[model samples]
Target chain A: MVEFTPDEMMTIAASRLLTNDDVCFVGIGAPSAACNVARLTHAPDITLIYESGTLGTAPNVLPLSIGDGELCDTAVTTVSVPEMFRYWLQGGHVTVGFLGAAQIDKFGNLNTTVIGDYHNPKIRLPGGGGAPEIATSAHQVFITSKQALRGMVEAVDFYTSLGHGTGGNDREDTYGVKTKGPTVLITDLAVWKPDPETKEFTVVSIHEGVTRDDLQATCGWSIKYAQDVRETPVPTELELNTLRDLQSRTAIAHSL
Target chain B: MSLQDAVAKYIKDGQLIALEGFTHLIPHAAAHEIIRQGRRDLTAIRMTPDIIYDQMVGMGCIKKLIFSFMGNPGVGLLKRVRDSIEHEYPSAITYEEYSHSAMANAYEAGAAGLPCAIFRGFLGAELAKVNPNIKHVICPFTGEKLAAVPSVQPEVSVIHAQRANKRGEVLIEGIIGVQKEAVLAAQKAIVTVEEIVDDFDDMHPNTCILPHFVVDAICVVPGGAHPSYSHNYYQRDNAAYKEWAAISADRDLFAKWMEDNVMSVGPEVFEGRVAHLRGAK
Candidate 1:
């Protein structure tokens, strides 16, 4: 049984959204963990694509980068960086973009560009790698975060990743960009989805140990907890155990 | 002023080079310059260095590559890069697990001038042993020696910064110190800055790094970083990089860009390319 951390739990919730037959555009950190966990558990059949040129890789252990040996060692195949984007991602082969962001907004928009303005930034973070493309290419997108007031913000300093900028496909509509909307947002507090009409973030469920007020207080924008919000199913002991064991293995390698 | 000449100043045959710019921070100019110059049999290290690395592999400028991610941000990974790795590239590009950890491991190790730094990533990871550039080495400083290490110290380091003097005295926003680490450790350093300042004194003394004495020369490539943000200078040209990404997908497109840009000139000519793209007079 896997005993998942709240952070890992958040990743798990994000992973649950994946299907056995998903071609996921994966990011490097938490999203990578969640996607790999899903591949290890229920969604073993999922095809994982990383910006680093690995396609359909299912490693036994988590990788440090897209170039990690496990990805190639366990990969079903690898493609060129250009092919990953043109032939697959932009070509609409990717079904889901599994990603993570430093800051999020009500519209499921992500910001990894800066903490402040785009030009005069407060903190210039790693700009969008393949994020902007994934945000604009995949048929559907899922975000994994450890929900906090700092990370889940009222607004982003810069739009590093354009998931649902402003509201209601505003980014896609105004931009003529194809791809699916940011279908889900998974955080520590709960899993949330955009309101159909307004496209604002609305809670769908509270994590096992969270509350409605908890969600409201942590949000930067006006919050909306799901009326039909159900309790997050607890991670089974097996799930917890396996995940922790994997984490420990990951920890052993990444431990500084 | 051509890539052929610019590359000669910083690179040589059989050396390893680490190109900078994270996702879209500083565009990798010198690496592209190297490829354009037609140098070969080199190795590279990166966490994620957009298409320049792919361009390097495609041009056969590299013998081996250690990286976490490589692609044209929006387009995809390079086809030749895949071929080199899968079918054996004249130079190979290998994959790893974490980006920051890889950078941190190599950066910190190089920063400290140690042989290698120990990290607890997934145990006995396969990527750790992929290349000798980063391997289990005795901590030159600690002498205590650790196992499971990843060290990335290139013989030469090329990065793009927002500002610099003609002598290559440079400044980058945020003081991430990644540049500092690279600057301190590398045998030689080449920086393509957004602007070339006349006087080092004009910039704050504290903000300055890679003193003119240590620098070779600075090329005022303006938008040298291209797809990347120029550290308080500008944001990434997602549209441009997206175009580069798409171009990377097709050899014809990539080759067209290569023939026109990379093969045409040196660092001095970089601004003209940007001007061409922007249609500036």
Candidate 2:
């Protein structure tokens, strides 16, 4: 029996959702790691696109950012920023958008804006890059983040990216968003899937160590569970080793 | 012309200037010169305002920042930018935020000489509510409501490229962003290149070459995009980004590092720092 950290479990779980044929718009940090893991292990044909204009990037190491030179060096091709956003992203060619946010609501709306007040914020977060388009344009979105009561809020202070846009097809009905909004929320403790009708996030599976009550306490909204909640599969040895190797390679590449 | 001369002649105080680079070929050397010359009250524009902008904001060289994303790339929040916004440390620098697509289209419109850029975005987001500059216009053709923002036509644009011919035409090879559009849109453009070759010999099929007529001036400055990478010239200095997180987190340390590395030295210091990365002596 092997144990893995929650971060590792969450990353592995997210990687499992990506298929070989999916064309994904990859963000930095955890999202990048998950996409890279999928490419290295199972999703070899996954086309990785970045906002920095690199299309079909096949980096040897995890990119430090969207603009990391390795992406260009190992990319199948690179396009202009306008062509990337207009033709590739908004043109509805992307299949998946992998993202991370500072705050997310039950409706799955993401906030990367301010914390307290927009006029005068307590903590000013880094604003959205390509999230607005990615959230609404991609056929589906996969969000990963650490779970806590503060992070999983009743409502985000400011919506930087549309998840379900207040749930219940509001994203499509009100905003005319073309794609199905966020399908899954992979967290350190649990995996959430939106309710088909309500579009609110509900826990479908818990990690190896977390409990139903633990999840309830951590979430800001009224929590619902699948009829028979299952435990997320423990990380396989191969998955663990592959992930660690990627991390080590990234460290070496960055000389950290 | 020298980088110093370019900055002095082309860049003016209180002008809206954009140093456009997606990730590769950022004009870090030109930015350092702006700091060295003590330019003030200028509005800085970029799609992703990275460490170079952070350094400029920290040094009080900017009065406002017009950007889509503000951060130190993969590391974390830009400490100096945060301090300037939150505490008004050096000064209270105002900002106008947009999504990546909006900025890209805005630059495109500028290049094409349009008054404003219109795109289908910000339908359900909070950006339009707070930002008065973000407007909406009903499409006459489709009667659809779409977002609009003024095109970003900078007074001057500074950028770095892989190489330039002796005739002052610039060539960029890999991961080209809006550098072409930005240069074309600016009233005046200053370019820094790795080398000034006799002529571009059979350029890459995908490469973009800015004609000398479009470029106002060109300076030969090797390793000009240090910390950021120039395609075929150097790799991004990831360690520098990590190191900057700590240094910019504190004002005293940021000032000390800037003084030691940037203000105290000339642009010539970048010449040989990345020769090994380029596979050259």
Candidate 3:
């Protein structure tokens, strides 16, 4: 058994959620790593799309930016940005929207816009580039973020992307969004899913060696555990080695 | 024509100008020329407002910024933009923000001569609450509500491409972002290219070509997209982008860097900056 860091474990867990049938709209950092890892390991035929208009891209190394030359060079086809957004994303062809968040709420609403007040911000985050549409337009969303009290907050400063609004039928009833906002959240400590009734995220699987106290300490709100809480399967040797190789190749390519 | 003349002729003060590129093929040289020529009170527009806008905003060249996302790409915060918004350094600038889909559709609508862009976005986001520009309209066909924003019709659009022919037909290859929509949406367009050939032959069939008629001027500036990249011409300067995060953090250092790098140099220096990265593809 190969030892994996918490980040690698989280990535592997996230990657396992994806299958070959998913046409994933990938965000740049953790989601990109997970999607690529899944492609290399189990899901070889997963169609990866970047917001930079690369369709069916298969880069040897991870792209430093969404529009890195490698994405285009290795893409099956590259379209205009307007067409990428209008036809592919808004046209509702994507199956999964993989995203990251600066702050997430109990309802899985995300905030990547600002920290404090909108008029006078304590920290002005990189505003949502493509997540807003991807959240509502895709069939479903999967979020990955390292857990901390500040990040896993009770409510976000601003709702950059709507997960379930205030739970229940808020996604479809209140906002007219038909897609499942956030189906699963893969964090370092646990795997969470929204309650079918309330839509508030509840811990379903705790990673090996992580305690309920560990999850509660990092989460802002009171944590909820599922009745059949299970241990997340550890990263397989193939998953660990494949992820490491990808990172090493990415480092070498980006260092140039 | 020279880049200097083109910038002076097409770009004006207090105008809505879009320097459109995604992460790839950004018009850094043209932005430098705009800075060197001292254009002021402009409202700059882009989808990702990459480092070029950071410099323009830091230099006090812009009074307003219309963008979806403003960041240093793969790197972290755009410090200069953060400083201006958080601390009001240089001067307080106004902004109108949108999601990337809204902005892209707005540009598309502008290019199509539409009044506004209507799309299914901002469903439950707070951006629509803050930015009144993000309004709602019911789709007449489905009776469903959709997001609507006014089309972005810029006075001028500037971009960098891989090549252009002697007839001034520009070719943009890899990651052909919203540059085409931006150019067509603008009243005037300026394009900088690596070189001008007699004709484009042996090129990929799907490449985007802006015809000579739509383009107002073509400047043959080699390595025009330094720091960013011109696809098939040079690689993106990731080091420079990483270095900018530190340099743009300080006001004095940013000014000095701008003085030494942009204001003091001609477009010719761009070619030398990317000499090692040439033919990187």
**The TM-score obtained by chain A of candidate 1 when compared with the true chain A:** 0.93
* Candidate with more favorable, higher TM-score: 1 or 2: 2
True-vs-predicted CA distance for residue B135, candidate 1, Å: 43
Residue lDDT tens for model 3, B1-281: 89999999999999999999899999999999999999999999999997999999998899999999989998988888888888888888889999999999999999999989999999998999999899999888899999999999999999999889988899988898899999999999999999999998777776678899999999989999999988878899888998989898889999999999999999999999999897768
Chain A TM-score relative to the true structure, per candidate = 0.93, 0.97, 0.99
- Most lDDT-accurate candidate: 3
Can you tell me the DockQ of model 3?
Answer: 0.90
lDDT of all predictions: 0.64, 0.89, 0.93
Instruction: Kindly report the docking quality category of candidate 2.
Output: medium
Candidate 3 per-residue lDDT, tens place, A1-256, comes to 5677889989999999999999999999999999999999999999999999999999899998999989998888999898999999999899999999999998989999999998788899999999999999999999999999999999899999999998899888989888888999999989999999999999999999899999999999999888899999999999999999999999998888
The DockQ for candidate 2, computed on C-alphas, is 0.69
Q: Write the per-residue lDDT of candidate 1 for residues A1-256, one digit (tens) a residue.
A: 3345678678777777888989998887778878877887888899998764578887766765454445655666655343455567657888998888888888877766457654333554544556655776688889887767898888776565576666876755654555656889888878898888778878888888687778777777778865687888877665566677777887664332
Model 2, range A67-147, lDDT digits (tens) per residue? 877887788888889889888998898999999999999888999988988889999998988998889888999999898
Residue B220's lDDT in candidate 1: 57
- 1 or 2, greater by lDDT: 2
List chain B TM-scores, each candidate.
0.78, 0.97, 0.98
Better of 2 and 3 by TM-score: 3
TM-score result, candidate 1: 0.52
Predicted candidate 2 versus true structure: per-residue lDDT over B1-281, tens digit per residue: 99999999988899999998888899999999999999999999999888899999999999999988988888889989899999998898999999998888899899999989998788688888888988999999999888899998999999999999988889987878889989988999999999988998787765689989999989988999887888777778777778889999999999999999999998998876665566511
lDDT of 1 by residue, B1-281 (tens): 22335568778888877776554335556766677667777777665645677777777777766554445543444666655655554455444333344455556677678876564221112223333444443557766323344456778877777676555567765323256566666777776777767757756655536677655555557767664445355434445654655666566777788888777755566564454334210
